[model samples]
Target: MYDFNSINDYLNTKIIGQTIIQYDNLTSTYAKDKNIFNTCPDGTVVLSENQSKCTVRFGNKWICREDKNIYLSIILKPIGKNLMISKFDVIGCSSVCEAVADTCNVECKIKWPNDVMINNNKISSVSCDFVGKSDDPSGVIISMVVNANMGTDEIDKINEEIKNSSTSLKIETGTDVHRELIIGHILNNVEKHYDEFMKQGTIISAVSSCIHNSAIVNKTISVMKRGKKTVRKLYAKSIDGEGRLVVADEKENEEILSPGETIIIYEGKA
Candidate 1:
């Protein structure tokens, strides 16, 4: 049994958690956070023990069991000079990767736009949604789902099909992990990285961080864009300033792809 109150109380004392709301159970923290985005504070964090209908980057269901994962959404009001959604995505994904590595001793990489991977298997997913425009916005709600503390048998029992493509901290480290600790680490890292982003006042720093820690950069990959018929196989060159995937084909023809679906073709390839 996890101590929700203790963790929530401790988290509220942190920088990113001015006001924290912890639901021992919920249908979807992301949906709920979006619903009350206007009323929440600038750095309000909504956490749940169980999310029955959690969603990831492509609106795919994030299979989460009761009291077994880190499911939360943070509502942030961008107060910086130039705040783009793409920059925020980079910050969020990088934050998760740093936090996971710091806590689990596993070096994870960003799989562009949002997914965090360890050994080519997804260990966490981050999704950012902005209600209004870049000039004038209500708030940016970032929903993150980190598969923490889930055992191999637990993951296999929940979604056997995706077990091969997905992984958790416990599965990688071969020990039970504390979800509360991981959440704390993530929130702290988000705040730290966000401050760095604010100081630079550009997405260049964010993009640089992603490129350095990316798992898909300089690798052969197949990209599947939304509503596109054909899949393109190209070498992932790097992440552009705007967070787009810059890829080139054999002919050396290059294309900058906006945030979409990308699959790494080879393992351990730079």
Candidate 2:
């Protein structure tokens, strides 16, 4: 259980975690109970011990171990902020990387846009969902799931591809980590980076951070092309200036896809 009273003891933030709502279970923290955004203040966090039906990009099931990980969604009302929704992706991804590195003392890599990888296995993930229409939006939900303390037995339940690519802090470090402490650090980090982003109003810092710790660049990986169901093998060349991925296919055809254009996952041995 996340002790609400003690969470503030670890927090050192101005926003992005001023309020947190905890639940024992939910379908998914992003949509099901997201009505809280209407009333709650900005940067409110909706946390759950377990999600009965949690899905990642393209409806892929996220095997959430009850009470064994950090499953939370941050609600942000950016409509009044006069900011682009895509900017939150930068804050979310970079914040997670910084927090994990600080808390776990392990090198973390960003898989394309936002997923965090440790030694090639996914140890954490950040999913940023924009509310309302594409051109116009009201809010954004940054859902994150960090594999904090799950062991090998718990991770084995996942099927082959995911099982092989997923990992946890406990499994990698051979120790149990305090979940609340990680969440607290993440909240504080997000706020700090977010304020910097607002002050500068630029995302090049984020682009540099991702490129510096890229996981897919210089590696062969599978990317489900935009508006297509089938995944393709592509050699990711690098991330461009605007944070778009520059990848090349079998025929040496190069294509650039923005962060929202496609989903990148490890399908085969790279």
Best by lDDT: 2
List model 1 lDDT by residue over 34-89, tens digit each. Answer: 88888877778898889878888767777787777888888877664565666678
What digit string (tens of lDDT, one per residue) describes model 2 on residues 1-270? 777777788899877778888899988888753666678887888888998987765566776888888888887775455555446666677778878888889999988776888887888777777777656777778888889899998889888878988899999888998888888888987777667666665666666777778877888988886778998889999776555788998999999877777777665422
The segments of candidate 1 whose C-alpha lies over 4 angstroms from its true place after superposition are: 1-15, 80-83, 133-136, 203-205, 260-270
| TM-score of every prediction relative to native | 0.87, 0.87
Q: Pick the candidate with the highest TM-score.
A: 1
Indicate the residue-level lDDT of 120 in model 1: 80
Q: Model 2, 50: alpha-carbon shift in Å?
A: 0.8
RMSD of each: 3.1, 2.8
- Give each model's whole-structure lDDT: 0.77, 0.78
Report the alpha-carbon TM-score of model 1 versus the true structure.
0.87
